[model samples]
Target: MRRRTLHLAAVAAAALLLAGCGTQRDGTASPAPPPSPRGCPAEVRLTAADDGRALCLTTGGRLRLTLHGSEDRPWTPVTATGGALRPVNAGVAVRKGDAVAAFEAVAPGTARLTSTRPLCARRPGQNSCPGVQRWTVTVRVTAR
Candidate 1:
């Protein structure tokens, strides 16, 4: 009788071990996928100074970008010129997707809201120098 009891216990232990072996097998659920790539990949290339960030290399000194006002907002771009992005003018409202007023950080880093011009531009020369409202994102710059 005792021998039979020992045999039953061993069999149960083996079954439990086998069950755990397949826990991570095909029967288990798969992990989630990584984030999708962005339309305009946020990156910047350089020559001598690499700060542990992404980059791009080019020959000519041409540029690549298309400034767009904030999504639904109505702010305009004044003078975006920092890191890599830029704006055409310097006297428009500060919209969401609109270009920034003036950027000058020519490296790889974040571009959050530094300053902003919230309310309507009612003051005197607010039309000429539209105040900034918020910084958008980290702009990578490839020195020319």
Candidate 2:
């Protein structure tokens, strides 16, 4: 009788563990997908122009991104995912103006571009820069 009780308890514990494995903290079965960009289609496709707006891209296409900011609040591209995109040129400025940062879509895959800028005052010789603002955009590349 003791052995039977122990075996039943072990089976119950295993069942409970398996049931909890696929649940999220909110008790949902699966995580939600990322939100689609506003005014964009639900399906992935290239936009008509590369006007720095977030949109999907066709494989082997080109995208032109322009980052603008003042000298004290300069923005810069931090990273890009996948090998489908390559930067053409990038720059920094002290005054508000357009800085062309172009990229090319090399292959069919999803990619992300991230840029950031300082939003708070910085002291001399300080290692850490606080109040950093980040901008991230997702791009889907589809084969033609």
Candidate 3:
């Protein structure tokens, strides 16, 4: 009886161990390549208005940004948006050398531009009062 109980317990423990065991994965899989930094080569530089705000636009090297306002007025919200940007001039493809950098004050009320990742946002205040945004840009290069 003692030997049988010991044998059953051993079997149960072995079964539990085997159930918990998993195939040992080998080494590591290399990390996936980074996304293209050449995403935008186009650039736009704009002058701010007396109210201290403006919007800019560019399609691959060609830049177009507009400005408006009183810099010291109560803060207003703003947003920037784009669709399939077609050139005012023809046969211009929005490619690497072609840039897309434009921001227009959609409205005059409490609106501002927020510079997030790949795109910028233009809209009125957030869930509260006025909002100000700051953006930093960096360019990088890597082997294909």
Candidate 4:
């Protein structure tokens, strides 16, 4: 009687283990499918032309900014206002005198991304430039 009970217990345990293995009717195990991507526009690319323009984005997406500048009057790094967007830590490689920065959508809200450079280059030890140049854009983020 004890031997029969042990045999039944072993069979039950084996069945439970195989139940979640996702076997097909033909007795072949099927691989689990990959998770589907969620959200809209996985990445948003921006340029100087986007300045002052309103943009939309989905959560968990990236924002890439590329602005033009010269060596003497290069743009400062991009900055985002409010809490909707956060700067990406990985540095973007600059190409052809373009100033680049990357950010990630963190929450559902509005944010202003801005970058600025000097209108004219100043000499070394100069405290201030003659004028300031600016670039900015508004972004609206939502969960999709």
Models 1 onward score TM values of 0.22, 0.51, 0.18, 0.62
Residue-by-residue lDDT tens digits, candidate 1, 14-102: 99986444123443322222223532233322211111223232222222222343353344433333434432234445445444343
CA lDDT, every model vs. true structure: 0.36, 0.56, 0.33, 0.75
lDDT of 4 at 48: 82
lDDT by residue (1-144, candidate 3, tens digit) is 999999999999999986543222442222222343554324434423212322222233433423332323222222333332322332333432122234322222222232322222333573443344333221111111
Model 4 clash pairs are none
Q: Which stretches of candidate 3 lie over 4 Å from their true place?
A: 24-144
RMSD of each: 18.1, 13.3, 20.2, 19.2
Top candidate by lDDT = 4
The model with the greater lDDT, 1 or 2, is 2
- Top candidate on TM-score is 4
Model 2, residue pairs in steric clash: 71-94
In terms of TM-score, how similar is model 4 to the real structure? 0.62
- Looking at candidate 4, what is the lDDT of residue 129? 57
Query: How much is 101 displaced in model 3, in angstroms?
Result: 34
